[model samples]
Target: MTTRHQLALGACTVTVAALTSTLLVTPDGATAATGPDRIHDIQGDHRISPYAGDSVADVPGIVTGVRTEGSAGFWMQDPRGDDSPATSEGVFVFTDAKPPVQPGDEVRVSGQVSEYVPGGADSGNQSVTQLTDPTVDVRSSDQPLPEARELNAGTVPETYAPQGDPAEDDSIDGLRLRPDRYALDRYESLEGMNVQVEDTRVVGPSSEYDDLWVTVRPDEHPTARGGTLYGSYASQNPGRLKVTSLAPSEEGFPAADVGDQLTGTTAGPLDYDQHGGYHLAARELGTLRDSGPSPERTRPQRDGELAVATYNVENLAPDDDATKYERLAQGVVRNLATPDILALEEVQDDSGAQDDGTVTSERTVGKLIDAISEAGGPRYEWRGIAPRDGQDGGQPGGNIRSGFLFNPERVSFTDRPGGDATTATEVVQRDGQATLSHSPGRITPNDPAWKDSRKPLAGEFRFRSEPVIVVANHFSSKGGDQPLHGSTQPPKRSSEKQRHQQARQVNAFVQDIQDVRRKADVVVLGDLNDFDFSATTSALTENDALRGAAATLPEEERYTYVFQGNSQVLDQTLVSPGVSRFDYDIVHTNAEYADQVSDHDPQVLRFRP
Candidate 1:
């Protein structure tokens, strides 16, 4: 039987000096085979394989797991492995097709050992050691497999990763693995090895992709709803692990929500991929136990209170299924209490994601307004400046932009003329009060910072005879930013630079309004696409111009979105000093649930004028 206990072996006497002297080095610095025949020797103690680019003949191992979908491969582990904790005993043999290998089959494979970076070299992702173009010879079948290594709270380290050497372009590939210190190192050491987590808690809800995230260390930055919190750049919650099934399609993958438990042991080979870094490609999955974590609903606003909310409708279009519209409408009416003014993000053009030149979102907004009305909410009136065709970077030709939905009975939208997609709205003094030059206008739409990004929509509204300036923003996304678990240490947030500039532009616009009237009722809110603690948020709230509502909540309850098992804040509502007292709630009707209307959770702020 192959097992973790049975797989441990005495240290291999083969040293790097011995292998380097005997192996032929290619022009690219990769060693040719003529070295040790074991998997540990091929993996070495570093992130990159020591025997990379080498073609070895007859490497022996027992098949531990097989993945039949999407870059199909099989992981095999040597029952007897070197005792070094830094070196992995198992490796993936990429056949690029369904390999005729089964668990418990002890086989000899001949292939070229290569280091495959998951998302290309420029993505700063760690490389996976694999045997490509393999020829396998199975010796025996139905043998006992190796015992899986248990990954629990006590095993994973608190630290995420070690600092990369600056000279090596901040790449950790050349660094020696320190499994005792870093969580990444520990995962790397066990790459492709049979691993298991017993009674693990689901931190991220199962997606349509048939994968979910779990946490072995339940106490690590736990959210109120049983999620791992990604509080800062420093604390990435090392216990989180993505789980995917290697079982046949008919066996079915579990659809889990946050706080649910995967009862019993879910065991498989630990694999690395581009999506969520290291994950367990489980051959045997645990039973999912319902823990009763449900979507949240906020208290309705009082009669005198003005409620403002922001929801990224996740590219809402008129042609979407009726259920999607109904669900979103229920979230707005029931979960969010149908706020007096709702700022909508990603409201696509009438044609949705189709590559047509449609820029107006009247039908898109009309469908949502109709849904809200059908859900027994107010007949909401909307205002927005549609972007030029394909200028705003979202689904191409979708012309996704930020817009406002105001309950006409409760609030009134000041409709000054001349607002358009490309024109910039200016703050002006009108009768000793701050007012937008063009109501429902865009804020610096033509600025270079807003190039290929969603331009901020600034609108003037009147709630209870008091003027409120609300800037609805859906800033540039963090698409190009390196992953938190990427090879680069302290992973670079390159996408933040443009967001910072956008923040500054919006802040300046807000400052200009405040300059006209010191105590202006200004509210900047929407999907900022950055965290509350980020520099982009700081830039908006700089000089005390606005206070982030998320920052005021308890640390455990601040998150409005969950990504890669970590609860985080991507949407926010920042209020100005003029709005003295307010209550904010991140209504989690989505994000945390398996059935979601949007990827983001809508946030509401209630205040009396």
Candidate 2:
């Protein structure tokens, strides 16, 4: 199985510096058009989405709400009781373009109006319309640009009443707007132009593409599908914009926060990676360093005990050897670093034409396996992989494509029926409810490519007659900094809902194992891609399903990843409820692990079954 380490939490810290913009609003002594005299204040609790009408054009309203996502993303309500969701399409343009705005900062906005239409099956937040804004001050009414696009239902009108200079270029601040026509063209002609586009949500390649997948919970609303849009960019071509720099929208809601400013100048060059119809890029990146590797390389490596570890290598690629990742595995295994069982993420299936007549779908995995055997970890063998067949023809599919590496001597593979984790008898019951066996949990089968990605690696083994189960996984990560499950966005209770789904899947799997074998030992390992303190982890641990190893370490040593200029733990290893019977220790060596080619520091947990 291929091990893919996510770089989101690691790279998110580069945003400490501000990427500011200057707006030169034309001096027009503008007065409000006589309309219904309705005033909305953002100081109190008034849901702003349904009213803001998915656009950031010059719609008049007070700074009713200010949500600081990375920069500042908030909502604006009109004096006429018109409360709509703010988006890049219309008057809803990001101000400061950073996040987490101060509660009561007043500002003015001017731009075209637009709406958000969920792509039929594409991965991404709502596509936005064009809007222009210059100045925002702490004050009364905001002005509207004469020609903002209007959303009639979910459809956008081709033409608008062009006000101002008609030929003024419809610029936001000083950035020249690039129309959807340009993007749909995939930058054929607009390639090297410093054009600015409103609501252009730049993103990195999917996990399978560049080791990142943002988690977005589908809404409870009948139409919601329970996840964020999945996309990928080309490895050969990359984007110039720093996508990780843009903040994510809040949990469930699909609109930008009112007054949300997303301003990133298109610095020449555009590279696109489209596996299906999804387009993404991974270029123009910024890096930061975390804790160094551990000094003690030989961490309690014994014969009978099981040494386990998990790390998000942030997408470990063969520096020079592409046909096989012998070197990649060498860095991880040679220093007596091999664990009895290693769960890996971002294992790519062979994509290129059948060169040299290799039939293996995953060259990376093959290389790693050979390298391990070449090293002392020769006893380890292949176990099972999740989503075994989902593949977008070898293109980057979901951000998570995980598998497992096992040592046959430590344990022998046992038989277990194959199916989704939600159906297992031992799985945790959905939150606030009991399972009826009659009513199975919800399972939205992902794209075929997703099948190739996003599945847990499961295997059974016996350590001296004691049956042990290992489930390796790589859950989704947080996308842009928008708050989907907050007081302001849609689906006010989205954050918890996502946690419940992930929790449900994990719980069910654990339960299944328990049901089949009484008192069996279970070890769950992989790059959860989520922090240990998050609601997702809370849900998984709430049932007391597994015992965490990091909890044994100090707060400073507990973290495995960093974000928002802060460090936190995301990679972890948890044992089933029976963990109290064994003694365990967690040794993080990513700093030292970095000395190799990988970014994630491998964590070592030595324990007795």
Candidate 3:
């Protein structure tokens, strides 16, 4: 959850090796060029400049915006408009801190046109057109900055794909963006242009980077959780735009969550680069107001049924001070309504990221248990078999693993013979009752499918005298996969193959018991790292005897994680056919908030075993 994709935007060293032949500069840093060096010509229709790598003498324009902080630079625009949608008139003039130019100053800048990819080139991101290593002479000051281009209804269409061939060869990157046809193209057309969106609704919460995603008027894809819901591949809400604050250090902008609306207007230069598509680099940000959606806590536990919850507490460790542990415990007690049994993933060893080969997490879970008790919740007794020292692919030496935290007063671990982390568990029938031969054992831990990933931990439990077995899982993550907006159409989920194998293994284990006792009341729950509609999820419940708990909610509401502007499902609770789920909810305190404790939201399932 703490991992950020931001790249390092180091200031490039100045080199005048590509100065244009016609360029001439006086000792006073004043330079002038007549033709070809105009701002529009430098910023050609394509992303790469026609004069890229060539230092021009006098690129004349009016400074539209001045960035005084962090790799300080100023933006300039051609006073005369360019009619072509593909051609951008505004361009960034990169320089050292606090350039002499101010907004609304018409100046003649001498610089090299460069394709500077913000963050870094290794980030697998697109490049932003900019003029770098600049020397500017202010021709005039206090001139009107270009008008803020307005975006309203129908300007940005609802379609994600432009009308064309949807193959790799016909990707959006290759096409001459048609602003009138697709929303992405519309923003691409206005790249670096001063733009404004009135009365925008903040769909994504502001992150530590002080950036948030917003949707302009006429987009109805907003979710109750304050994200733009992509219903299908075609339901792309073009009104959605990311906003990066230029004034984050400014006080009084209380933290904004999902469903909060920014009133008035946000005017700034339209920017397109890495960091998940087009955004408005707003200079004049609007006021943020609460949009009425609030944090949600699951219902209180009821009699005759036990509540089970699953959460991946993002590499939680004991040394994280007391704040993180306390917040998580409070989230469980309040947001999760104190589930009787909690399945946790990514529980790092007591040493956390330290590589001292400490593979036990007793201190980690114990601290959380103490916090829970301090928060007025029942004391939870946790159990797990520490994985082989460095086998798990999580934090090295930390040996991240999945485990169970149950209210011992309401539930008790049913320990049988033969339990260890290395050996696989077998299904054995004892006195006509279906049970794991090795209670609280690892499921196929040595299997190649679990190589470097958390092996599923199986444990048999007695909840109010009803025998039930639950499997805690933390599947392979979806990293290193192609992005949806990448050149590849529909993108490839390379991580799904391992997750599918893991799912099949779990499904086979569940099927083993269902063959003998069709109503065994077994439950499989945790961070599966795949959506409910994914093939991995299909393989998990392929047997008619089991079903996913999220299926009970409306299809649009079956989400446990949010990405970009889309709310998705990654965590799940699957129960046997006879174990009907009376109540199922995804606690919404996390995932949609910037101050979230976990990237994946906790799911609570209530059922009678």
Each prediction's TM-score versus the true structure? 0.94, 0.46, 0.89
Clashing pairs in 3: none
Rank list by TM-score: 1, 3, 2
Model 1's alpha-carbon lDDT is 0.88
lDDT of 2 by residue, 343-455 (tens): 67665545423223222335545666776677656556654332334331232432225556667766565544543423332333333222222111112224221232244
Tens digit per residue, CA lDDT, model 1, 232-264: 889989999999998845756777899899999
Go through the candidates in order and give the C-alpha RMSD of each one to the true structure: 5.9, 18.6, 6.3
What value of lDDT does candidate 3 attain over all alpha carbons?
A: 0.76
Tens-place lDDT per residue, model 3, 1-609, is 222222123332222223234655534686645336676677666545677776676677887776777757877888787678767778887876666656787776666677776556544344677877665656667999888888877566656545434664434455665677666666766767788889877777777777887777435665656677655545556676788765555583446677788889898888765667677877788888887366788888888788888999999987897888889989988888888889999999989889887888889999999999999899999888898888878877678999999998889988776777698888888777788888778998988899889999998898877778899999998876655544434455678899999999999999988876777888899999887877888899895756888878866566777776566788888998869656888887777776788877898888877
Off by over 4 Å in 3: 1-21, 24-35, 47-57, 69-71, 118-122, 163-171, 231-236, 252-254
User: In model 2, where is the ten-residue run with the lowest total lDDT?
Assistant: 215-224
Model 3 lDDT, residue 289, Cα: 88
Pitting candidate 1 against candidate 3, the one with the higher lDDT is 1
Best by lDDT: 1
Clashes of each: 7, 88, 0
Worst 10 residues of 3 by lDDT: 1-10
